[model samples]
Target: MSAAAAATARDALRAATDAIHARLHGLPALQALAEGRIGRAGYVALLRRLLGFHAAVEAALADAPSLGPSLIPWGIDIAQRRRAGLIEADLATLGAALGASAGPVPLAPLPALGTVPRALGCLYVTEGSTLGGRQLARALDGLLPPGEAGRRFLLGHGARHGAMWRACCAALEHCGAEPARRAEMLAAAEATFLAFEAWFAGAP
Candidate 1:
C-alpha cells in the first residue's frame, strides 16, 4: 500500500478537513483572539458564543445513548472531556467582573449524529480544538486576568492536553479504520466545522 493508503484515520481526517480548518482560522473573531487584539468585551462575546456551541455539541453527545458505549472500548469518556460548564463558569466570572449578566447564549443547529462514526467525527473537530486552544489561551494571558478564572475553556486540559489529544486520536483511528466508516467520519467532521464557521460568523 502507498503511504497515503496506509495513513491512519487521524491523518486522513487532518487531510480531509485541512481546507475547512483554514477557513475557521480566517474567521474575524478567531483571528482577533489569536492575534490578542480582541479586547475583554470581544473575548467575553467569543466565550459566550463558544458556550453556546459547546453546550449544543455536548447535549448531542449526551443525548446519543449509543455514543458512550461506542467510546468506552476506546477508553474515551465524554463526561471527563466536557468543557461546556467551564465556558459557563468563565462567562459568569467575566460577567460578574464586568457587573453584567452572563445570560443565555444562542445555540447552533447541528446535523444529526445518528451513528457512532458520525458522532466521532463531531468529536474529532471539537477535541482537536484543544490543541490550538493552548496557543489561544496564551494569547489571552495579558488580555484576561492572567489566571484560569475566566479562561478555563481555553486552557482546556492544561498539562494533560497532550495525553488527552493522543487518546482522542487513538479513538478516531480505531473507529475510522474501515473505509466506509472513515467516509462517514469525514462527512460529519466537515459538517461540524462548517457549523462552527457559521456559528462564529453569525451574531453572537
Candidate 2:
C-alpha cells in the first residue's frame, strides 16, 4: 500500500477503535434506559443499536484499502454467521448475563434489536484484525519457507484474536447478560478491542 493509503487505513482503524470505546462508555447509560436490568425488550433495543454501530464500522473498514483480503472475507463471514444463528452459544452466554434463563434467543425473534445499531461496529473491528493478521502470517510463511520468525508472527497474531475473544467472553460472564443487551455486551466488546490493541502494540 502507498504510504498515504496506509496512513489513511491506520486512521480509519483508530476511528473505529474510538467509536467502539465511545459505545462502551455509553453502555451503562443505555442499560439504565433499559430499566437498569436487561429483559427481552431491553435486549432487543440494545441489539438494534449494536447492529447499527457494527454496520457503520464495517463501512469504514470497506473504505480502508490497506486491509488484507482475508480481513474482508473474515468480517463478512462472521456477520453472516451471526445472522445465521452461529453465535447462539455466545449469545446465550450474554443472555444469561442479563438474567435470561432461556437459551439462545433467535435474532429473528428480536424485532426491537433489529431496529437499532450498536455492537456490529466493534465486531467488525475485531474481525478485521483477525483476518489481517492471518493474511500477513500466511504471506510471511510463504515467503520465508517456515522460519521461527514467521511462526512467531502467526502465533502472535492468532494470540491477539484469542485474547480479544476471551475478553469478550469474560465480559459476558461478568455481567451475566443476554446477547441482545447492549450495555453488558458493549462493555465486553470494549474489553475485546482493548485486548486486541494491547496485543497489537506488543507484537514484533
Candidate 3:
C-alpha cells in the first residue's frame, strides 16, 4: 500500500476497535493481571492456559484461508512468532522456582468466529495483546518479592511492540474498511476477547 492509503487504513482500524480494546481492558481477567491479584502458581496456571489457547488459535488461522493470506505481508503468523514457547518457558521457570509442578491446562474452545474477515478480526485482537503484555509484565514485577524469572511472553517484543501493532492496524485498515467487513472484524475481535476472558477464568 502507498503511504497515504496505509495511513488511512491504519486510522480506520484504530477507530474501529477503540471501544472493543477498551472493553477488553476492563475485563476481570485483565484487571486481575494489572492488580497483581495472582501469584507464582497463578501465573503459571495462566501461562499453561494461554499456551493451549494459542495452539488452538494457530490451528484456526491455518484453517482459515483469509487470515493467513491477509497477514502474510506483515508476517503475522502466530506460530512463527513462537509466543507459545515463550509462555511455556515462563511456566517452567516459574513453576520450578516454586517447586510446583505444571500440568496440562485445559484448552478453551475457540469461538466459531465464522468467515475469513472474522478470523482476521481474531488475529487483530491476539496481535494487539502484546501491548497489554507490557503492562502485565509491570504488574507481575509488583507481585512482591519480585524476580526476573517468567517474562518471555509478557516481555513481549519489548521495543518492537509498537511497530508490530502498527503493522496490524495497517493490515486491518486495508482489509476491513468496508462496512460489512468492518462489522465482521469487530464481531470476531469481540468474540476473541470473550473467549480469552473465559479461558483465563479457569486460571488460579
* Candidate 1 per-residue lDDT over residues 1-204, each given as its tens digit: 321364888777877788889998888889998998888888877887887898899888888888888788886888988998888788778763223373455678888887888888998999899988878988987777777888788888888888888888888888888888888988899899989888887854
Tell me the deviation in Å of residue 81 in model 1. 1.1
Task: State how far residue 185 of model 3 sits from its true place (Å).
Answer: 0.9
Lowest lDDT 10-mer window, candidate 3? Answer: 1-10
Residue 153 CA displacement from its true place in model 3, Å? 1.2
lDDT preference between candidates 2 and 3, better one = 3
lDDT of 1 at 66: 82
> Residue 129 of candidate 2: its Cα lDDT?
39
Candidate 2 per-residue lDDT, tens place, 31-140, comes to 34323344444444443443333343444434444432433322323333222121222234334222356443222111111111123334534444344434433543
lDDT of 3 by residue, 1-204 (tens): 332233454444455556656766666656677888877656665666678788777766677666566567644554555476677777667654223364554567787654656766787777777877877787876663464468778876667678777766766776666767766776677778778766666555
Candidate that would win on TM-score: 1
Global lDDT scores for all candidate models: 0.83, 0.36, 0.66
Report the CA-based lDDT of candidate 2 relative to the real structure. Answer: 0.36
